[model samples]
Target: MTTAAGRTLHAGALLPELIAVRGIAAVAIVCAHALSMATRGHGGVPPSVEYARLIVDFFFIQSGFVLAHVYDRTWREGRFHYLTFLGKRLARLWPLHVVTLLVVAALVLAGRAAGLETENPHTLWSFAVTFLMLHSTWATSDLAWNWPSWSVSAEWCAYLAIPLFFLAADRVRGSAARIAVGLGLFVACAAFSELVLGADIVTLTYDGGAFRIIPSFFAGMLLRRMFDDEPALVAMSPRGYAATVGGVLAACAALIAMNATYDALWPLMVVLTAALASRAAQPKPGLLRGRALAWLGELSYAIYMTHAIVLQVTFTSAKLLGIGHTFPQRAALGFAALIATAVVAQAAYTLVEKPGRSLMARLLSQPRPARAFAAAADRTGAGR
Candidate 1:
C-alpha cells in the first residue's frame, strides 16, 4: 500500500468526532431510560427524552460507515475473509451483550421469586433466543430481557449482510448514483415499515428492528464510499465548518418546529454526520475531539450494554426507598442513576469487554493446523 504523505492508515481509520458522537448517543439513551424508570408511576416524561430513541438509527448508520471504511479496501482487493471479519465483530459486541443479558435475567428472576412485579418480559425461550443473538428475528415480545440488546441483535443481522451490501453498493458507479441508491434503500425500508408494519422506522425494535437497520446500514456504507471518493469534505476551514454544522442544525430544528415526520430527519442526519466527520478528519481544533469525549466514545459500547441494568437497579432502589415522586426527587434520582450508569459502564468495559477482545484476538492469531485454510487466511491477512 502506497502511503499518503502525512497520513497513516491507522490514523485515517480513527474518527474521534464520530466516537464522541457515539459517547453522546450512549449518554442520551441512558438519560431516556433513566427518565422512563423514574417516571414509572409518576407523570409523563419530557418530550425530548421520547425522541432520544432515534439515536439508535444514528448507531446503525455509524456502524455501516466505520466498518465499510475499515474493510472495504481489503474486500475489494480480495483480502477479506468473511469469517474473520465476523469473528472480529463478535469479539467487539458479544462479550458485553452476554454479560448484560445474564444480569437482566438474574434481576428479573430474583424480583419474581421475591414476589415483586417486573415489567419486561423475561421468559426462558426468549433468554435462549437472545443468548444466540437471534432475538431480533425470533422473539415474540418487543421488550424482552435486556431490551437494549435488541439493537445489538439487529447489528448482528447487519454484520451478516455486510458482504451483500458492499457488493451491491460496489456495482453502483458514480457518487450521485451511490447517494440515490442509499437514500432509496432507506426510503424503501421506511415505506415498507409504514405500509405493512404500521409503524415508523424509528419505533421498530425487537420485532421489526431488522428492517430498520438494513437501510440505515446500507446508507452508511454509501456515505463512506462518497467520503472516500472525496476526502476533501473534511478540509473545510474552521469558520466554514462551523457554518456548515450550524446550518444543518438549523435545518433539523426547522423540521422539529414543523412537526415533520421522522423520515424527514434522515437527510439532515446524513449531512450532520458528514460535517462532523470532515471536521474530525482535520488536524485543527474541532467540535467533538476532546479527551473526555473520546474516552466516552471508547466506553460507548459498555455504556450502552450496561445502562439498562444500572437504571433498573437505581429505580428499584429508589422506589424501595420511597423517592422519585415529586419533580425534585425525580430529577435527583435521574441524575444519580446517570452517574451510577457511567461508573458501572466503566467497570464493565474494564473487566469484561477489553479482556474478552484481547482473548479473541489472541485466539484468532494462533496458527491454524489446516494448510489450505491457513494459506487463505494468510492471503487475506485475516489472522491479524
Candidate 2:
C-alpha cells in the first residue's frame, strides 16, 4: 500500500499474535482495575494485579516496534507525511477515546442527578485536559471521568513525537549497537526515576508517565531494526520458537516475583517485551495466532478504552438492583461485569471504532475541491 510519495504501507505487517498479546494485556489491566475497585483501597492485591501494571510497558515497546516496522522505511525514503501519519494514528485512537470520554461524562452526570456520591467530580479543567490528551503531562490533576485514559494521553504524546524518535534512531549504525544503546538509556531513565525523582517507574503519574514510555518505546524501535537486519533471528525452528517463548514467559514470572520484594525490575520488563515482540512477528504456529485470539486482538483497543466505563455502569446497576455486599456475591458480580465489558467492547469495535476510522480516513485522504480547481487552472494557463 505504498502511496505516490514512495511511502510503503505494509498491511501484511499487522502481526496477529502481537495483537493477541495486546488483548491479553488489556484483560489483565481490566482484572487489575476490577480487583482494586473491589477491595476499596485495601492493601492486598494478587501478584497478577500488581504485575499487570507492567503491561503498559509492553504497550509502549510494542508501539515503538510496530510503528517502526510499518513506517521506518517510508520515513527513510522521505515519503512520510507528518500530518498524514498523525491523522491516521489519531483516527485509530481518537474515535474510541472520544466515545468513551462522553460515556463517562454522561455516567457522572447521571449519578450526580440521582444524588449518588461520585468519587471524581466532573470538572471543565479535567475535561479539557482529557479531550486534548494532555492529562499525562502533569502531576496535580486527575481525570476521574476515565482514569485509565492517562495512558492513552501518554501514548498520544508518543505518537506525536514518533518521527523525531525515528529520525534519531536513523543515525545509529548497527542494529546490535542500537539495541544496546536503547537498553542502556532505558535503564538510566529507570534509575533516575528511582534515585532522583523518588518515584517508582511503575506507579509514576502524569509527567512520570512520559518518562516511563520513552526508553521502552525506543528500545522497541531498535528491536524492530534488529529483526530487519537479522532474518535468521526471526526464522526460528518450531522447537526453538517454543523454547524462546517459554524462556521469556519464565523470565517474566521470575521478574514479577522479584518485583514483589525489590521493586526495580522495570528494565528487565523492557527486555521481555522486546523478546516477545520479536518472536511474535515471525509466522509461527502458536496459540496467539488462533482465530479467537486474533479477533480479541482486533478488539483490544475498544476493550482497553471501554472496560472502566462498563465496570462502573455494571456495579452501579448492581447496587440499584440490591446486590448483596458479601464477598462471594461481589466476586460473582465482578465476573459478570467483566463478561459484559467484553460484549460492550465488541459492539464498540463493530459500531463506533470501525466506522469512525473509515470515515476519518476518507475525509483526510481526499483532496480539497479548491486545490483541485486551482491545479486545473494552473495547467490551463501553462497550455496557453
Candidate 3:
C-alpha cells in the first residue's frame, strides 16, 4: 500500500521507475516518428505507421503525472505566484523553443536562398503565433512548425492549469467532485477535438488534434488530487501493488485490442500515466542520482524541439540530392540523420536551449508579482 513517505506505492520505487519510463517513452516516440517517415511525405492512419503515435500519447500523459508528482514539493514551500510558475516553465521551455525555431527558420531561409523553394506564408502572423506558443492549434490542421512543437504547447498549458486543478481539489468535498471535474475537462477536450479537428468516430488520424490531448493533463490533475486523499488505498501489500500495476498494463493492452487508437485512446493513456506516476513516485531518489535518465529528461526538451527540424532537413536534403533508391534505403539514411540529430540535439540543449531559457527567465521573471500564496513554501505544510 503506502510507503514510508506515506504516499501510496505503485511499482519499484517511484522516481527510478518514472525516470526509466520517460527514457523508454522518448525512444518509443522516436520509433513512432521513424515509422511515420518510412512511408510517403506524410504519415497518418495505418495500423503500423499510424498507431505508433500512441507512444507520444503516453509521453503526454506522463508529462501531466510527473508534473503532479513534483508539484507538491515545489508549492509546499511557496505560494502559487502565477508569474513565477509561468516564468519557471518559460525557463524550462522557452530556450529550446526559440533556438529551435530560429534554427529552423534559418535552415528554411538557407534553402530558399539556394532556391530550394519552400513555404512560410502568413510570415508575420505565423511568427507571432509561434512566438506566443499559440501554434498549438496547428495540431488540428495540416500545419505544424518544428512539427513536434504541438506537444510543448500542450505541456505548457497543463503546467499552468495544474495549480488551479490542485486548488480545485483542495476545496472539493470528495474524490467524486475532483474526478468529475477531471472528466469534464476530458469531455471538453473531446468536444474541442470533434468541433475543431473534425475527427469523426469513423476516421482515425495522427492529426495533432488538440482536444485529444487534454485527457492526459486532466488525468495528471486527477491523480494529484487522488495522491493527497488515498493513503489507505495506496498502502497495499507489494503483491497487491503488483496486481494493480498488472491491471493497468492489461487495461492498456485491452485498449489496443479494442482498436481505440490515437485520438480515440487519449483517455486511456491519461489513466495509464496516472497509475504509472503513482507507482513511480513511490520510491523517490536522492539528489544527483539517475544521472543518465535525468540527462535524457533534461535533453528531452531539446530533442523534442529539434527532432522535427532534423527530420525535415534530412528528408528535404535527401530529396534535393536525389539520394536513395528504395524506401528501405532512405530509411537507413533517415536513421543516420536521426543519430546525427541526437548529437546536435544534445549540443543544442547545452549551447542554445539552456542558455536561451535562462535569458528569457531573466527577462520575463523580474519584478515579482505580489500574492499571498507566493511564498517559498506552503504555510500549512501537509506531508503525505
Candidate 4:
C-alpha cells in the first residue's frame, strides 16, 4: 500500500531502496575490512576505505526508521510487549552471532596452533563478554571474536531503549520538538565522544559503544515522521527522489575521494540514507527493484555478520602462503575475499540465520496460557 504521504508499505513495511542500500553498505563494510586485513602490519588502507566504517551509522538510522514504521502503531495501541519485541529481535540477531563466535574461536585456536598471528581476543573474559553481547557495553577493552559483532551488541542496546524512545517520540507532537530531540541526541553523543573518547562520534566501538548508535537511531525515527508528514518530501516526484538519492551518494563519493573529514562525511550519510528511503517509497524506483539487489538485501545481515570470519581465514591463508605482501597482491586478495564472503554469507543466511530466527521466535514468543485463561475469565465475568 502506498500512503497519501507517498510512503510505500510492503510486507512488514520493508523499504526496497533502504534494503538495497543496506546490501550495498554491507558489501562496502566487507570490502573495507578485507582491505584492512590485506594491508595489516604494513600501513593504512586507502583514505576512502578508512571512512567506510561510517556506513555503520546508516544501519543505526535505518533501524530506527524501520522499527518505528513497523512497531510504532502497535505500541501506541498499548499492546506491544517489551519482552516479545526484544525476544523477536534477539531471535533475529543471536543465532548468527553464536555461529560466528564459534567459527572465530576455532580460527583463533587453529591460527595459534599454526603459528599465525591474529589481533582478535581469545581470553575467557573476552569470550564471556562477547557471548553475552556485553563487549560493546564496556565490559572489555577490545572486541573479542567476530569483532564486527560489536555493532550487533550496540544494536541490542538500542533495542532495549525502544520502549522509552518510542514513548518519547510519541509524546513530542510538533515537528520542531521531534527535530530538536533528534539533533540533541546526536549532538550530545558527539560532544561526549570529543570530550571522553577523544575522537569523532563514528569512531566509537568496543569502548562504551553500546550508546554510540543512539543519535543516528533517533535521527532515523524523526526522519520517518518527516517522511510521513512533511509536504515537500511527500509531494516529491519519483524522478526527483531518484535524483536526490543519486546526488547525495555522488556528493558523498566526491567528498570521500577528496579525503573529507569525518565531520563532513557524517551528515552526508544521513542525507544519503534518507534519500534512499524516500526513493524506495516511490511506486517505480527504477533499478532499485532488481532481484539481485533484493537478494543481497535479504542476505545483508548474514553478510554483515559472517564476513569477518571469511576475512580472518583469507588473511591467515595469505600469511601462511607468504603472499599478499605487496599492495597489488593485497588488493587482488581483498577483491577475491569479497567474493568469498558473499558466498559464505549466502550459505549462512539460507542455513542458520533464517531457521534460527524462526525457531527462536517459536521458542520465546509463544503466548502464555495463563494470561489467555485470565483474559477469558474476565470476559466471561463481564458477560455474567
Point to the candidate with the largest lDDT: 4
> Model 4: residues >4 Å from true position, as ranges?
1-12, 41-43, 367-384
lDDT of 2: 0.76
Q: List model 2 lDDT by residue over 237-322, tens digit each.
A: 55665676677678767766675532345555555555555455454467778888888889889989998887788777878998
The lDDT for every candidate, in the order shown, is 0.80, 0.76, 0.62, 0.81
lDDT of 3 by residue, 118-169 (tens): 5535255665666666565552333434656756766666666666656654
TM-score order, best first, reads: 1, 4, 2, 3
TM-score of decoy 4: 0.90
User: Candidate 4: which pairs clash?
Assistant: none
On lDDT, the stronger of 3 and 4 is: 4
Model 4 root mean square deviation, Cα atoms? 3.4
Candidate 1 segments exceeding 4 Å error: 1-12, 367-384
Q: How well does candidate 3 score on lDDT at residue 165?
A: 56
